[model samples]
Target: MLGTHRHLRGLVGGVAVVAAVAAGAAAHASAAPAPAANGAAAPAATTQKVLFDDTKAETAGNADWIISTSIPDPTKQNASPSKETDWTGALSAWGVALQKTGDYTLDTLGSGNTITYGTGGALDLKNFNTFVLDEPNNQLSAAEKTAVMQFVQNGGGLFLISDHKGSDRDNDGWDSPQVIQDLMSNNGVDNNDPFGVSDDDLDISSGTPTAINDSSDPVLNGSFGKVTSSEIDSGTTWTLHPSDNANAKGLLYTSGSSGNTGVFFATSTYGSGRVAFWGDSSPVDDGTGESGNTLYNGWNTDSNAALALNATAWLGGGSSGGGTGGTTAGSTTGTTSGTTSGTTSGTTSGTTGGTGGCTSGQLLTNPGFESGTSGWTATSGIINTATKEPAHTGSYKAWLDGYGKATTDTASQSVSIPSGCTTANASFWLHVDTAETSTSTAYDTLKVQVLNSSGTVLGTLATFSNLSHNTGYAQHTYSLAAYAGQTVTLKFTGVEDAQDQTSFVVDDTAVNVS
Candidate 1:
């Protein structure tokens, strides 16, 4: 929104709210501890991975909708940033707020990359819990539209931001509204009013849209605090269609209107995913960004920051995808909530073996990586002391597929179970991070399987992603009694898509027979 429309409409107007609060301002510049979620701390290993889109001309003209100039990883800008100014971007305040909470991992889809999905691009939509496209200036390609839709359909959170019509800064014959419209109508996925909100052909000069009265809604009464209103500094509105999607509801409305006709902000769910739409990009404008550009701080005014952050939390953790909002550790999440921060627990059942008393001792060589790759055939560099990923126990562990590229890593060992043994259990401590999420697509995965002495598949035990959402290393136990009495190979295979690293670390393994 680089135009003079904001100036033409006067900037002195106040937005209505129940109270005077600035989650954005506090989140923007505060060095204090971040506001606690539900008055409790979040799990260390579980982080909401968010990807901000910058490849869609988000910075065209005065629009600097980026977390930081640093691509992919924002920490590189300032190893330990305490303020938004520490990072160079208009949305740094938002990024800094999430960082301080220690509950999120932020990334940016830099200019050189294209929006993609199954192609395995490290920045693929499948890898992130939430994707923010603020006031995009360019149109979406066929592939880009499909990638976005599939990302949502497969349980990803999508945040769509738009500006008033005729505000095409890129002069690409398409603005955010038109581009977003095309994405919903011509995607590779379903095209049946996907998000259930149609962009009205109107450029609202200004409006202070107030939030709806819904005490049960987490987006309004979230940990960030109660949200009362959102500003429309020269923005647009949307027409909601609950008929297409029952969950499609307007959250904020234009002045003097309460129905879905004058929706300033709206949210909905399609398939197994969740989505949010904002008519104007002004609320996110922190009024701070790169040099030589005029910006505004709409982010700090009214309840804009709370609205945005809470909505982000809702989108991210409100769904069963990679989101981190509205969810706590050890809690079971529904399709509407985020993934569980606690590690999943349960025994993966395999071929059944007889139950009996201990007859044979634990069988396996180099049970841990402390002895390196000895007695274990593995890919080069699979066993290392590098600290990029922490081991479950000792200084050594079997690290696999952290290359953030198309690759596979494996580690395996053979052992013979005594025929006298009637029961067996194979257990291991595994840690995972990155690309593996609870999405519709298994972009990254760790497969645990059993193979006969001849290298033929005996049975598949279990699979893990992103380390099973554990605090760090969670123990995984599987029943290997089915294979007792026969020589078998226990193998771990980690597969990653095109980009972004998904490290599956294995340490301290054992197979016991009774």
Candidate 2:
């Protein structure tokens, strides 16, 4: 699903004929219009061709689509990294398969023969109906930006994948930030600044949840599941705030964190071209193992791959199947593919709720906070202590402060497992909200460890550091064993710079097994 054009050379027999007949009928109906004075009908509008840039020679006549990535900045190793090869490989397989069912092509463009934004390079966007900005990290040059804007404004289709944190590697520091700020601003999007986690270290373990907004849109109208690969060692989930522009429509949002934050997929009019923006690149990375990895499976099965195909088809003015289409007032098309529908019969169902309250086990909370009537409490004397609240709330809530605190706070709670239970799984949702704290410097030492009944440390479940704690939550799940019937103490030792007032939070504490 990564390459530009996938060539399918073969002859169609009966299926092609049937499809042609259906297409002809639909085309004829859609072509209806008025006749001229001379009694001759006006020529049908030309179908917009989706042009893939061939400057890189990765795509030429073989491509009906193309993929592009940001040029790596040599000075910065931590800047956005390019996954051109991986994207190309994935897209190529998808393009080849799609060609069997439809008339289309795919291609690729890279640094050497890259299509300059305004140079009118290999891609004559006017001839194309859609373009994809796959994993672009560097800021587009002024001219390139203008060209893309023009293309999208001219009724082309566009799909954009913004990078996750650290995707861009520029030593200069200014390169990646400047580039993203410029691109988003030009697109009429106000960067999201939720709860102040924007500047914190990136959260790498968060699950990839689809945005709740615009689930009905064709591009996202299906029950697409998540997949993970082994290549990606770790990464964090992200939230995307909506733009203020009226024409833009928010399509998706991540779940379990602060509302109005998380990943956002949106559609906006860029003149004649329709543009789709995916807030994060984690779902489409070459390396798997991370959440949302299913997006990179074989082109034939991956939902993300199907979305790419639908984008190209819509951009080319092809028949709308998966629901996406041009914005003509009253158009009711949904996405053409990637939806899941079915039902099971005669199957037993289980209760859809959290495990029962702790009944026979011991409850142990962490230091730096005190137990309150409903939950743990933070003292008023601590700076920003008001942010700390009770930790454990039923099975759905954690037993610790979900956000980090500058000063040490105590977290305590009670738990009781069934008397006969021999084994249990202790897990909870941990939101590393250190980014929301008002600290100018980065803090790296945040620790969550478990202790046995003898006060000896049993294990450490999570650790995060060297991240910009601007404001975003990181979810952590830990496993505990050998202490099923005994109560154990859990502790949070904040090792961040005291001068910076760095701390962390833990919530949604639970112990269960089924």
Candidate 3:
């Protein structure tokens, strides 16, 4: 359920208190935080990219998603595209906010991209850091699912905006709810462990949904302040399973059928990436639209605009120096270049026995390579001490060949297995930057192998090649239950062909035994 609040106007605990104050009142209530008093430091802005999805046949490819307009709307319908009517699109206000405060560039994926991967015409997931899929009425193909999953697993942000179960805009066989379910369930994705949550089976047709007062969450408070109210015309909800994923959080909730609770907004983590799911798309619409089409003054009607902006900022790498507005870290509202800083936590520095050298569940020492590769054996390549590319977790990661090199590299770390432990799991983050072809004959590959204490290869855990096409760091998990009772070594072998180059990076090596 959505957690408690301090002084929300329309929500109390888990129940809706009242219809959001009139549109004008909401605007006055949810205004951006005032500028710093007495010339104090202002919140800085984050520069990021957001890609709206249009490949799913949304509104006949018009998508109705764009940034806000600078001009006023006309009395009559203006169907043709023009700068004056940019407000007619659903995401106009959101895009405008990103441009003004967050320094974010927003664009839509055209029909040509096609959402598929590895078919020679597949959309390149590396081009954008965040992907927004709203009101998808088409079923996702296997390739599309794999592409999206891999994209998110590799530190990409995904915003899933769905609608009511049967609110199929197009008369196609698929709907937003069903397609989202397919994406999160094993039945369609063909994996034992899915994304770990699915939408709740409830459609609220009457009252609106109250934003849960979650002050601690960055998404609720980040650029927009607190999210108090959202217009939910007719929307569904989500159900979070903490057993499957420990990071799932319910951001919006309401009374469900039979006096139970329902969650309409939820956030979770898939591998090293972040995900947010909103139940409805109407909250993004701006009143302008063609005649005979349903419209909503959602951006100004409630805290909808602020909610969208906050969600976007959170999805784009959480807080940037914990700053806001367009101010650089040490500069005034307009200047740039003041140095962006981040902290690294939980590094292994000599301790042993648990995951990442922790006292209990930690297992690997110097797993992040922050201590200059003290715990691992390397061949042909070395730890990348320079902070060129961001590490998946800590401050350091092993670079197989420093990109653009045609050479083989190997890195290995040994772990002691507890005799009483019945389950063991090995996981790490890997980044692949390659110039090789992603076809059947791809030669630059990263192979994960398990070796017994006697220097004998037990098995090959997995092989990642250019066919998967991950341009960012993605978490790879392999079960080490087969070596539970014996000490073994996990080795990452990067093989590069003589022609093209591939850089294989490994970081945050961890083994959980219990």
Candidate 4:
């Protein structure tokens, strides 16, 4: 029952090869030239290729890499099946992201590609700068192993990702493949058990699941912040061999807990190539219940996607030319596709003050909102208060304003947003003094508008009535789709009659895009 996944069938190997070559050519023709090197034409960059030995073809688009999997047929050794469809879907999504960032060209292994044992089935390493090994249960043949080693030694990148355990050999027992063992040894990794620290085993279970921060490494810098720990169902366990090789660096490690176990290892400079080995493949899986949510999924944001992209970029000689000579995969070019769009996910909150504020509970540092400061303003002839007005019983304070006027002389404050927040949204809370009565006959209103960096009104997101006379706080929400991805401002345009002056307070301001 081992290696029992379904395989792809009716795969016209020759036709697939033709289609792949044509696609690559078309993409290449459209691509801009690689950045120049020392005023001369740069060396031709290597292609980003991926090998899929699993069952799903739909997931082929996930990587900027070309897809090459065994044809479909249960009886065939590398046939496509539904069981591996989930992994395929995940990889496909990743590929799409990678392609958009100018990292690599994605393709599939045509049916014509030989599925031989060992290096025989090993693709011509010359064509690819990196290979993503995602075999579900099938082990690499001896020839495949030799080809992989040669490919690595000759400056290729190999990202070997193992599932919860190695492969489910009989739907009951799990077994590690020799290909994985060889990979570990080649990269100076030890494959010993959970408790061993010697060169025999790279036991990840010995480490703890902890967060990493403040590093210059491209993989971490682009993450924007720290990586959160999630539950791993079948993560592999490993410990690196004690070596002084300057090229070797540990990218991520686990803080082994009862629920979260295993270490994530990354190595560079294997032969002339780079390799990243992981104990868990779930982070990048695209199957059902695996698309979103960092708790269960592999990569959760653009930062997460950068990890794989950086590896490919480095292996492809895409690193900056001064030393390596190519752009990081994060800079790859292509449009993004899939269910989620924009900034992925965001939380909401509120705040009030003369200066425009962010939505409550939202991080306000990105668009340049001063930390711990209200992002709002009040109009002239108005009693504006910038003191500690508690939103709830909490100790945090918010800005308050009493008595407003319609004249241009009224006091006013606003929150200025940095460029790139054009397509954002804002939410916050407002409280009006219910007892205040204005004798003036003019209409009073509370307004929120999205404006360009030059103060041009792009669109109105929200406007509230009777807010100047409210007894307590009310939550308000608005979307900035009209001004997304641009440098814009969130304005609280309030108007009051000349004779009527009322007090208002605001709290918890959040700005974000889902």
Candidate 5:
């Protein structure tokens, strides 16, 4: 797949579109507009880190996809002339946008730490809030898949990008389609929907694929800009199974030749994390390609640049336009059944239902673990009441990885949200002090998960790490408005490294509904 000259042959609408030829056309001279935030100053990007994966033999070149080399003219043109430096060519623009906005720090994974799951020799998802896999040429190892799935479940963002079928650039048994299919399937996303409908399939589409604007999707009508349309050269399409993943939403679609509509881009929430999938690599391609097959200008065309930024923002726990999981500090509007005539108070116990009934205050189950793990379920590791120094509230709080066992410990509780809850809030105090070394490579972490009835992780509410450098207990809150009328589970997990000890303490966990 290294610079394969195939888009011209795959032109749609019977029109021949070639990247090499397109670059030779009338060139537009322009620079990318300055990064803006709703006509205001763009926020500092220091907090978020975007990790690009080059471990799965992403392409033929080692530095080809590196963001540092991707510098393209903002004006319209064909393939970028800086192919060697801009290996991913226009695709580098995506990273450039994120970097320029100072919204995120872009990094890449090279030959070291091959992506593995539950292992110390691979990429540690804990270091990053989002992961980007663009056009991986090789199949992922079982550990890699596990790492990705669990990472998302534990509240990490993932961007799964793929090209058309037979895009086996390295002649590997896996393409993006097969790899993603397997990844999603193993993670409870079925290749087929219930009632025997095949919803998780991928195929190649011909011609210039029109980008479907789903206004409801934050990636489209996001804070960056309202994405109206985008162009695709030759790309593949993916189908989503919302019936299986309730948080799954199609953001971009293309009507193919055989009465088939292809999903160009889609977003879904898994456990507290967000996942987005795009079907083409050309959208980020510059003019660089292998040998004679160069790509066209995609980063500057349409809303591709904005799309990249918006996607990054959303995945990084921020939104372009108040989309799902926006990190902005404010109360979110959740879907409420009806207006409440009164304020409701809740208690500190009860697993299945709001047993204490509803009151006018926050609710929790032994918020301080003073009553032991009565309402919560401990699955693994040492998750019990601990009488240690620096208790945020009472004499005891929940302690995980307590014994320095080098394990993954978890404790969870189910809560029944009361009716007339127009909005809800879940807050907790966290304390972390660890002896683990290397913030990026270490596995010691504390993850907060949200689960549905079937115990399937719906979203990752939050993730805490010793890397945070918290001097003491800190208060963290998440909007539970998304779960206003439902019964959900809150899972607290502690993942420790094999060597040093990491202590994760939690107390004063509260859920408030109004």
Candidate 6:
């Protein structure tokens, strides 16, 4: 599809609508933005890692809340299970579903293992996008709790599953509720109830989950399906502390309860990561597991299956259980989420990635230039590592056109705005230095534009000249909503005169979508 181009109104606040033709340079201007890498070359791709905890005696008793019987990689039992019975675990359906997606790599923190961060362990908390603790019977050590809290504070997802109070499967004196509460109130990180979601002590024999009127929530209405009412099947409930964590909110509630009390499930954020709380593990139990173990197939009784899968996907990252996963463009992306309040997910400034039809997050890869040109296509020598023109943040910056002759330099990256997103914004910090002393004439110029896949200019977001130079870096942001749902290239081109030299140093770039 052809792209719609917008003209830059001025230095800022430009929002003009216009049509763009198959673009080429003017009679004496630079050529069109170059095509991306030849062959199958694309942005670097990445997979979200999820580590399910079994070390804390998850299988100590009749509670078989495990993705698969096989430790670590679940595929050891079956490469892919068409049905829940294909694997010998109560939560096999959950593991198999994520495995089939191919966008996630699931691992089990088996018995006797310890949760850690920055230790470089293959299964360290830092290595995973999401950490799952389903009905853990053993209380976390002080260090272990610190690791989990620090992980969430530094851009990681946390999934907390709880059981009824005093229901200690391992008879270890601790239960899921106490353990989870301990992690929240007694950790090295912010200890004042970080996520603002606590497991209620009440053991609900059976009840129905009443969905809040939130349709945009990826967990309630996500890829797995819509969550209307879920089965309790011997579960507990959660009480939210919205005052402690302002982002905390209830998604599903118990019958007749409202506000912050009697919350069946809650979600919140801490620092740069996300937190999700579920009252019980029964909804995740697939029922078919090791024989002789009494299990309930609550996974599909109501909206339990959808809630479990969607919550997992949401906790894993991106726009919940939706957004593009494997990409032709090598994946230069990460996942982030918001609660039902849409504090993180539903903002005017969209993020980079999206799944299926839904999309959000920061889109540009190697956005800070700290990774050199790994995800960008730039003219040779454009990605600068030298310190002549300081980067906005890190050591590297994209330098275009410092030659004291008639020359042109360009750099760009291609990104896809999923069809589901309604907003997209491109932003970057630029430092312009020039030897030219023109008070009125615009001798050297740099243009930031959005381009079609075929190298056609879709929109001219901004233009900077020698007159626009400043002592420090200036941030420029443009609305790219017109190019939403399209694979468009963000291009920056600089042109210079034969006498004066002007350099366009750019760093910390991003294309956020929603």
Steric collisions counted per model: 15, 109, 10, 123, 29, 23
Superposed model 6: Cα runs more than 4 Å off: 1-46, 318-514
Q: Which stretches of candidate 1 lie over 4 Å from their true place?
A: 1-45, 318-514
Candidate 2 local lDDT, 198-270, one digit each (tens): 2112434434444343323444432122222111112333333222222344444444444435434445442
Candidate 2 positional error at 337, Å: 37
- What are the per-residue Cα lDDT tens digits for candidate 5 across 402-482? 344467778788987676554467777666556554423335667777788998876655545544323355455666665
The TM-scores of all predictions, comma-separated, are 0.56, 0.38, 0.55, 0.40, 0.56, 0.57
**Deviation in angstroms for 160 in model 4?**
1.0
Candidate 3's residue-wise lDDT over 1-514, tens digit each? Answer: 1111111112111111011111111221211222243222123333455667766766543335433322222112222334334444556556555545535545566644567422322234444456789878787776677667655543456899888777666777777888888776632222423344687645677446676654545666665666776767777877766434435667766544211237667776554346888888878877665445566667776677767777766565521111223211111111112112342334334334444433336578777776655778886335654444446655566776434446678889888867655446677766655555433333666767778788776655555554434434445565565466688888888776655556666777777665
TM-score preference between candidates 4 and 6, better one:
6
lDDT at residue 510 of model 4 (Cα atoms)? 60
Off by over 4 Å in 4: 1-88, 110-123, 169-178, 185-208, 222-231, 244-246, 256-262, 288-296, 301-303, 318-514
Model 2 alpha-carbon drift over 4 Å, by segment: 1-90, 114-121, 169-178, 186-204, 211-216, 222-243, 257-259, 285-302, 314-514
Decreasing lDDT order of the candidates = 1, 6, 3, 5, 4, 2
- On the 0 to 100 scale, the lDDT of residue 484 in model 4 is 34
Report lDDT per candidate: 0.67, 0.35, 0.56, 0.37, 0.53, 0.66
Off by over 4 Å in 3: 1-46, 60-87, 116-123, 186-190, 256-261, 318-514
* Model 5 C-alpha lDDT versus the unseen true structure: 0.53
Q: Return the lDDT, model 3, position 268.
A: 66
Error of 6 at 344 (Å): 24
